[model samples]
Target: MAALGMADRPITVGAVCVYHEMVSTAVEALKGSHIPVAAVSTGFPAGLSPFHLRLAEIHESVAAGASEIDIVISRRHVLTSNWQALYEEVKAFREACGDAHLKAILATGELGSATKIAKASMVAMMAGADFIKTSTGMEKINATQPTSLIMMRAIRDYYERTGYKIGYKPAGGISTAKDAVQYLVLVKEELGRDWLEPTLFRFGASRLLTDIERQLEHFVTGRYSAAHRHPMG
Candidate 1:
């Protein structure tokens, strides 16, 4: 994984997303590299655990030195149109995260429609999430351009209303240089130049970095490398 971080430029990933139990290991391995260990919490992928336990998980992850926490919102809240409840729920998670940045996962693929995805994104931002993510990568569907587009629009609207800048991360199914380039283009076109940076945008993908590195190597040396040569986190 550290080998993957050796790559240069826009192709180099911003953070390595991991599960809670791996947070300490990731933090130790990534030391002095400036790469953040983003751990999934709040009963991630399903988020159906007891509320207290979820909040405790967030604290444990932070205590273990996870720089960011990607928490999943209760899907029932969004499906039932309980906006205030969802806002409060996310806000509690944000508080539990303490100094660690919070990225609320909407699992857009399971939310049923673009409207729900947009609304959930807005509610997460309103609740003080530092970033809004597309999915947990465990959904039947994860991170589509259409859903991502809706989420990005919601982020834009939030920025316009509050004058606060929230980050965007499109996790799952984003592989290859073309897909990354497309996402970059979307951010550049929708949110402008500032959002192009890692502080604003990220890919919560495991294999995406290898592909991006391969493309970079091909561009520079005019040759492609084996997948094993680019060990990702």
Candidate 2:
């Protein structure tokens, strides 16, 4: 993903996410590169594991040297309208995160309504989530522009009330330069340019890097190239 002059230029993705076992390797691989290794934790993509086990997984991932933790929230809590449970669970994850940034994945596609998405976003942020994410990419629907709009509005409301600028990530199904630009435009028009930076905004899909490389190649050579022309770093 960094083959596109990411080491020399400021075009790198904010972080590279991987499973817990790979955290140490990714940390060492990215040492001194200023790129954080994100570990997916809390029984990611499903989050149905025992509560203590889930928290223990977070500790393990952090112990393995993950600079950021992308955790999945218990969908049952949100589905049952249990705000207090969700808040406490997310807060526990934040505490377990230690110095690592905590991103709460709402799995918005599994969520039934936009209001639920907004509320989940607020509850996660209130519990000290460093970023509120849209999905795990395992859901049937993920990272739609409409869902992103609701999440961004929630972020705006949270910032206005609490003075904390939480980040946003729309994962899944984003694979082209045009798709990325649309998201950028959405964030700019909704949350302003401040949210455009890596600190506050990130695309969670990896295929996007390949497509972006292709677009840049076309821009430079004035012609489209085959998919194999670009190799991910």
Q: Put down candidate 1 lDDT per residue, 3-115, tens digits, no spaces.
A: 44544543446888788989999999989888889999988889999999999999999999998999999999999999999999999999998999999999999888878
**TM-score of every candidate relative to the true structure:** 0.92, 0.95
> Which candidate tops TM-score?
2
Predictions in order: lDDT: 0.89, 0.92
The runs of at least 3 residues in candidate 1 whose Cα sits more than 4 Å from the true structure, single-residue gaps closed, are: 1-12
How many pairs of residues collide in each model? 0, 1
Candidate 1: residue 71 lDDT (0-100): 94
lDDT of 2 by residue, 100-125 (tens): 99999999999799889999999999
